[model samples]
Target chain A: MNVIDHVRDMAAAGLHSNVRIISSLLLTMSTNNPELFSPSQKYQLLVYHADAIFHDKEYRNAACKYNMALQQKKVLSKTTKVRPSSTGGTTSALQAQNLPSEIEVKYKIAECYTILKLDKDAISVLEGIPSRQRTPKINMMLANLYRKAGQERSAVTSYKEVLRQCPLALDAIIGLLSLSVKGAEVASMTMDVIQSIPNLDWLSVWIKAHAFTHGGDNQRCGTWKHFGI
Target chain B: MNVIDHVRDMAAAGLHSNVRIISSLLLTMSTNNPELFSPSQKYQLLVYHADAIFHDKEYRNAACKYNMALQQKKVLSKTTKVRPSSTGGTTSALQAQNLPSEIEVKYKIAECYTILKLDKDAISVLEGIPSRQRTPKINMMLANLYRKAGQERSAVTSYKEVLRQCPLALDAIIGLLSLSVKGAEVASMTMDVIQSIPNLDWLSVWIKAHAFTHGGDNQRCGTWKHFGI
Candidate 1:
């Protein structure tokens, strides 16, 4: 049937939300303005609409939307194309490509593997990122992966690397600090951090005390009040 | 000995990097100005320095630092008393006098438990957060947790919930989308997304296609090429 007939039938069949109609029109328009959609709108339909469907328990439809999104991203990343525009304006090259830079793509791939519970695969993808270019975010992810995989030694290293990469990376710092302080080594360099940051000294001490309690250092933990923190 | 004396001695002892001086001074300051540090700085020191200590296999020192931080946090949290400032100004409460109000705290607590290999504890901490307030972040954590626990039903539900909460939450949407779009459903929602947002059609297709591929739907995955996204 023609697009119009399909629309009429869909309307007649009560499947005429703007989402459905727009989706149908999008298919027709794809022949022309292939790259005309915005990420936000695409996200809304592919991600959001699909999510709503998923939430409504329509797993099949939701899956289709997600698959469609990924397909679009792959094409943008691997191919270069010239497509026509819907407006009368000359079809300027649409650069709102779904393809992220190599680094971003790698990160996304890692994230996907992690989501799939393929820890080894996720680690492999993350490990492929050249060290220098590994941002604090990636380091954080690595730390999480290590921790999740029960690689405490590696996780510790990644967490430290995060701090070295971004001395001000609060999340990483907190993770590290919480670790040491909880271990009851307040006299360690973690204490130096509490000292330097000024505002968090008390918290550092409190966490330290908790660590002491956990570590059987009741002597230090009980004296928390004496220190006046 | 006075703080300056300690610095001089440390330098004489071949510990002259600004890092050492800063660390020593920070340690001293932490003793007096428990509330003078910022949370980020405090967390940083805990992570970087404390992590080094822990990894140096200096569990003893690491525990000390961790204890100190925890003590400080607790005092700031449970106590109402204001800490005196170094400049003799009115009391400045640098530490977190109150519990963390952000969702990250839950995540951090979860991290702590994870590090301790207390999976049940970590899960419980996360479960305490109100669902509405839970971010895409916590969803990922919960998904991982459920996945690890081999609760496939729960894991899938959590993943699906993430999509429902954020239709645009690509991570979750892609996971579920792959399921339905593996040639199971007629064309992934790429067309629909593009139709919804005409200006950036490829983005819609890209994300869906990506989701489809990730979901392991090799068949419908090819449909993405049809759109040339």
Candidate 2:
């Protein structure tokens, strides 16, 4: 079997040592003979090496390789699109099937940033994804990342937006609830947002906190204090 | 104004110093004259203080206070549930309204862990939430926490499960794509999963990568290298 085939098999079998060895060899071979490898091959080689490094927790290096793959992908798409007819239908099909979407690649890069604790870079990459295209999962990710970065207002807003889209969204609900409970005047916009959740069991809890903090029918709270548990 | 009212007003107005003064007064008064504040009221004081500290980014302190608030809430619930009639309907309503849900409290705790970079603790808290009760946001949160904790196999599995439930789940898809691209053999179940994604532009790329590494008709790849972009 050729080196690539043996490496592929080793990778499929979870042979990290073999996968690493072949990936390095392939990368070196491709690097020395750049013209011999097609753009897609270049992308694949970078990804293979990145994947190997990434598996070893070499995130920074992996990120660099993944970045190069994306660059190759971009160049491949642009140049290939320009000469669609010369490459023909098969080429079109190949191009269409191969190459991760821009969002997918960016997401990978963002994940790398996150692993490295480069919160700002991770947010930047994730933010590149269009808002309308954001799935609930993506929104949650963005919200958490924002929260971690201590952009409290933006984080709370993103979490609330997730709640607005889905009332049952527990993470956002938890996010909002925590934000409400943690000390942002329980009377602000985030506190007010509890009303948006339909019949949420925790709504009353927030309301009570607001009442305690802001002057809401002290007599009722007093009566509870006098006799209530 | 009574201490609670004064504290509430100050907290609402973002007057941290004034809120602190009133809350302290209430706490002391409650300690001196236990009858003056109900368990809920005491819990509210702790939360108020916690909130203030939390706003100041005193997360460790805030977390401690929040934990105490939850302890008070737990004790209050137990005692209140036992003597339902003595407390009356208003008391029932008050108790119900005043205490955050167990899930909400746990979520807040998880937030503290996340801020502390205690990813495993965050995951444990989030995972305690029942799967059926998990909103997309929660699942995403758990998945990410798992990933952050270096539970890659579990992370990829969770991401794929999210994708199974939601084909449009971009984060999960990207997660799977990245997992597939990074180090694991491109020819395994990960590659097979690409077939499940309908009309995704990136499926072919993974298939191509797998095929390239594992020896899938090298002639085709060879031809592509010769003429394909």
Candidate 3:
């Protein structure tokens, strides 16, 4: 089997350190002999190495590798466009290959930054993603980092975005409440999303309970017991 | 769409709280009318409810639901055997439906127990998994729980099992060395597993560095700079 297959097999078998070591060796070889692999193959190798390093908790090195992989991907795309016929593969085939998107790479980079306690860097990386393409996971993460960084307004906006996409995200609701957003307003935001569900009145009650608890309204919090928590 | 479809779509959309609430409602309806679903369907519902609850951070309730799911799966397998023709589906079809295995359910139960600070319960649940079927994840969790519960010998055995399966499991190696196992001995254990690698003499150096750090032998640890970590 080729070295890539060996690396993949080791990864599948959960020999993560071995995968990291072997992938690093392959990456070094590719660096020394650039003609050894096509641009797409080089990008894949860098991502594999980065993933293994990430799994091994070498976040700083993993982030560097992920950045390198991103650059290689850009090169692959540019080369594909400039000389489409020379690449020896159809563009459709290239698209079908399970390559990670730019957003995913950035998300991973942000994850490494988060783990390294560079919240500002993580936030910046996440913010680079266009708002139209931001998933709830991305919004929630940004909300959390914003809250941690004392960017209350941005945090509130991000949390609201999360609630818009996923009304049942309890953490996002709590995040908004903790930022002094009104409990009633936050609970109402979920109303449209949950209208289809029968007998979901208890959800609003649950949200109110969280809000009351966060706002220190002990009397209203006590009333939730009547609904049988 | 049916309630099940709704619940699934909500789950896919990351509306975990909605999934939990709706699944609970359906579960209540199914309880009132036992004929509403087949044994396997009931098992699937219980697992869905348990997963949603798990995601919602309600560990105690999630554990209960998972246990109930396991019981339902038992009923499913039993019913399948007693009247295979009456179930309206082939046994293989039932098997192909992505139901969680016994080991997987036990792992989830153990995870909840761990999160709830019930380490003893977690250890017992993990221990119930037959020895031969224990994966590295199970063994690693069991090892950590054993260490926390002051069962050093059992922890050592489990960690060793982990290292045996995946020699590059750095945490397990560190786990062994932390229990006073010699660095050289731990390093030697990985030799047979990693013999295929062309240049891996640095692995022993890496292990020795960890050992020196753990043993507080700073003098020897300083020499690792020669290898360029």
Instruction: Choose the strongest candidate by lDDT.
Output: 3
lDDT of 1 by residue, B103-164 (tens): 55456556556666667877887887887887655766676677677666666667666545
**TM-score, each model?**
0.34, 0.39, 0.62
Worst 10 residues of 1 chain A by lDDT: A10-19
Q: Write the per-residue lDDT of candidate 1 for residues A1-229, one digit (tens) a residue.
A: 2222333332232222323534544555653655655432343334433433443445445546655655555554343343334322333233343222446545655655565577897788788778888876678788878877877777778877765644434345445544453344333434554466424445455455556655666676775784554
What range of 10 consecutive residues in model 3 chain B has the weakest lDDT sum? B1-10
Q: What lDDT score belongs to each candidate, Candidate 1 first?
A: 0.51, 0.60, 0.78
lDDT per residue (tens digit) for residues B1-229 in model 2: 2345434544553444334544654576577778877787787787776767765667777778778888888888787788878868796887677444556566666767778888777788778777776654456566677777778887776765554544334345445555554323332434444455332334345345444433544564553342233
Model 3: per-residue Cα lDDT at residue A149? 97
After superposition on all CA atoms, what RMSD does each candidate show versus the true structure?
16.0, 16.1, 7.3
What ranges in model 3 sit over 4 Å off?
Answer: A9-15, A88-92, A192-195, A227-229, B1-72, B79-87, B90-98, B101-229
Among all windows of 10 consecutive residues in model 3 chain A, the one with the lowest summed lDDT is A1-10
Interface RMSD of each: 18.2, 18.8, 5.6
Q: What is each model's TM-score for chain A?
A: 0.47, 0.66, 0.85
lDDT of 3 by residue, A1-229 (tens): 3345555555665555556665775677677778876787677778777888887678999999999998998898897788767636766466537555677778889989998999999999999899998877788789989999999999999999988876666668888999989988998898775566655566677778878888988888985794565
